[model samples]
Each structure stands twice: as C-alpha cells, then as structure tokens.
Target: MKRLLLFILLSVFCLSLPLSAKAEGLRFGVPPWPGVTVKSEVVCQILEAMGYKTSQLEIGPPIIYKGLTTDDVDAFLAGWIPQQNEMFLPLKEKKAIDVVAINVDEAGTSLCVPTYVWEAGVRSIADLAAHAEKFDSTIYSIEIGSGMQVSTEDMIANNVAGLGGWNQISSTTPVMLSAVQERIRGKKWVVFHGWQPHWMNFQLDMKYLEGVPGTEKLVSNSVVYTVVSNDFAKRYPQPYAFLKKFYVSGAVQSEWINDFGFKKIAPEKVASDWIVANLDTVGEWLEGVTAADGSAGIDAVRSRFAN
Candidate 1:
C-alpha cells in the first residue's frame, strides 16, 4: 500500500508540471525571407539542444505583426526596423511587442539596376529620367505592402528619383526575381528594389543606384532585429533572456544566406550543419542564459545536442 501511494504521488507530481517543463517547444514566427527563415531554424536547433522543441509559424508581414500583438506568436527573428518603422511604431505605441536585439546590421534594401544599365550611364536616380522609356515607366517591387514598396511609393510621391510618374508594380519576390532574370537574359533595362546579404546579389551582377540628392538612398546598416511578444519575457523570462543575449554576426548570417540562396541547400540541412560546427559561437549565446527549466545552460544544450 505504501509503495502504491508513493508511485501515485510521483505520477501526480509529474502531471502537475507544465507541458513546457515536459517538452520545451518554443514557437518562432518566420517571414518568407531566406535569411530570416534560415536564422530562425538555426536558433530553433539551438533551443532544441536545450530540450526545447521549436516550431515555425510562417506568416506575411501583416499577419506577423498581428500575431505578436495577439500573443498568438512567441517571436520573429527578422524584424527590420527603420524600414519597418511605420509598421512597428503603432504596435510599440500599443505595447504589443518588444524589440529584443539587433541581430544583423549588415543588410539593406535599395533600388538596383542591371550592370548594363550602369554601363549605359544610368548610374543615379536622376539618370533614370532619361531612360524612362527603356524601364517601361514602372518600378518593379516585391510584395504590395512591403517596406520597399512603401519607400518606393514615398520616393515617387515626393518626386525624389525623377520617378514621379512611374508606376509601382507589386508581386511576390520570386516573381520579381523572375522578371529580373528575364531582363538579365536579354540584357534589357530594368530598375527594381534590391537588397544585400541576399541570394539575388550573388546570383546576379547588379548595381544599386545612387540616390537623388534629397532622397534617402538605401544602404547597409539598416539593421534587422529580433522581436518578441510583450508577454514573452514576462511568461518565459529565462528563454527570453537567452534570446536577448543571442547575437549572430553579419558575416555568419551572410554566409548562411549565400549558401542557402545559391547552393539551393535545404534550410534544415544548413541549420543543422551550422549548429554542429559553431557550437562554440552558440555557447556564447547561452552565456548567463539558463534553460527553460533552470538547468546549467551549457550542460543542458550539450546533453540535448550530444544525445
């Protein structure tokens, strides 16, 4: 009778623990960007090493913002600010989300044209005016609501790029890339939004046009950050701290983006490979960061990964 009572007590105690205590699954949100997706996977793998199960909730820009506000999502690794300033400000004002840390600052979105366009002297925003006919009087952009579109519209509205009359066409990134590829194949003139640390840069020999005198030219240092829900830190302070302390260098992220973008390697494989080789770097992220259950950080990660 005593043995049975002890067994029953042990079972009851185990049942009382939170499911997260039994299975540390962290839900991370990812947008369609390759770098963001890849980095999130890398972080998730690291968390998994600490006995946490990580799941990605893929969402568009608007949905991601909504998820954070509703606490339907835990975190997003790709929060590009300043560019995303308009979107984040309202949420911030409402105290719906928290900016965790600046992850990679070596990236930017800018207007770029083919090398041929540069060769033909279309070197600046002002240069586009002369070749408006060649560009079909249209500015190719990614998604309709993306920051690039917003910025492009602003430029057109303000008549900063001599593109005041140009039409902005919205489409998915892949579609825009395909259009670019078509133009590249025929060596035709095209002007579109571009960014660095992306596969497109590696895949194509392109040039970012210098901004017109009064307009802001997109350049590097447009830092991408990590964002979490306002309730995240409060509910899971330990994991939140780990995320806050986490930092992935520019070179590291660029390399991963290059590999995934150009080599066409699977994201999971890239993530797994990166995690295994960069244990030391990842160790730094775990510094002073404990597991969700309050175990030794390094030990928990090591045991989890090594197993």
Candidate 2:
C-alpha cells in the first residue's frame, strides 16, 4: 500500500541522518601540532573507553574552523587565543562555534631568544632593535599564512617596536626549528617564535619576551580553549558533556609533547600510558559525565583501562 511505502521511506530518511546528529560518534579537528596530537589522542581513548566511536580530521586551523562551521567537525581541542582569534572570533560572534573550556593552563605563544641573548640585554621587544645587527635584523617564524606569521608580519609592516625593515623568515615548524637550533649551537643571536606546553620550551634554553608595544595579542593568550560546533551540544550532549570536563595542565602537556615530539613515541601509546599513569585526573574529567551506553563515565573509563 502507498501508506506502507511512505512509512518505510520516512524511516530510511531518519536513519540516514548524520550519526553525529544522533550523538553516535564525534569527529575531532586535529591540527599538526605536537601538543594537540597527544591531547586529542588521550581524549579519543577516554571516549572510546566510554563506548563512543571517534574520528580525527587531520587538517590545519583554517580548514578546521571551516569544517566546524559547516558541521563537518564536532570538536576542536586547539583553539589558541589571539593567534586564532582572527578566524575564531567571527564565528564566535555569529554563534557558529562555542569556546568551551581552557584545556591547558599557563600556556602562551611569543617570540623568544636564546638565554645568551636574553643575558646580553635583549630581554624585551624594545631591546631587539638595539641588537639588530646581532640578529641580522631578521625575525624567524613558522608557516606561511599561519597565525604567528600573520602577527609577526603585522609587527614588521606596521613598524611595531621598531621592527620595520626587519626581514621575516617563515617556513614549516621543523625547518624553522632546525635553523633556530643551528643558530643556538653557534651561540649566534637568534630570535624565533616559541610557545609553552611544547617540546621547544624544554629543549631550548630561551626566554619569552615581554614589554613589547604591540605584543598584547601575542603575550596575553596564556591559555588554550576547546571549540565545538554550535549544534555540538544540543545534538551530541553526551560527548559534549565529557569534552566540557576535559582539562590538562601545562606541565602535563609538555610531558606529552616530550614523549610524542622529542621521543617520537606513537601518540596512541603515549595517550594510553598517560591515562594509566594518571587515573586521578582522568577521574576528575569524568565527573558528572556519562558513557555512551548510559553508564557512569568515570566507572566506564576505569573499567576499560583497568588492565
């Protein structure tokens, strides 16, 4: 009968809706950063323990923001303030995404120099101009069109802190770090972009600059937040609840970076090992959270990782 046919078609249509809309699983936008790599992995493992399936879209920040707006990605764990505000703020104003939580504490990104350079009176942005010859009037940064690159270019183009006419070198993270490392080996004066909760902070003996005229945006973003799509909560409240509870300290993130970035350990293994080592924090994150199967979130996680 026609009525039967209509019912079946409607059922199929409902079933074909996005699994995320039904809160079946979650998609995470993962940018190519070491701290986020392990951080996302740890969250994925915790969610898996709660019986939820998870996927990661390995992409850049711009694309990730686009995906979030389009409902293609449900969550992003690496929304750095000020640096990402160019792309994030507009969406936030439009209510396209929600800045959920500040996952990492004591976090920041800014230009820094070798300890020797800092010891030689190059402690602040103003001092860099005095020793322009030592640094060759060059500022090193990472990635073309990246947030840090954009900010550095602004500093030079607008002549902030006497940076006008200073050459800005931009490249991939690894390449830029290699050049910085080479300069450090020779103890040559070099200034490069750096951030906390990253291996570079530990590996390199350097100092984060302060007292820059136009560095309020750069130096003030000392914490990173979790960003989720607008519908992420209403559509997937279960996962959203767990995500809201997620938080990590700067020291913990740096340890994760060391294992995943410097030691080259697989992020999955690193996440699992950290979970096993820090059940107390895991329990804290699971407070008032529920698993996919409707069980207590903390209990589910503990049971899964009991081994």
Which candidate has the top score in TM-score? 2
What's the TM-score of each model vs. the native?
Answer: 0.85, 0.87
lDDT of 2 by residue, 165-201 (tens): 9987765565577778989999899998898888998
Backbone collisions counted per model: 1, 0
Candidate 1: segments with Cα more than 4 A from true spot? 1-25, 217-220, 304-307
> What's the lDDT for all of these models?
0.74, 0.81
lDDT of 1 by residue, 117-230 (tens): 899898887888788999988777766555676778888888775778888765556556777788889988898888866878778889988766645634334878888988
Clashing pairs in 2: none
- Residue pairs in candidate 1 whose N, alpha carbon or C atoms collide under 3 angstroms: 24-53
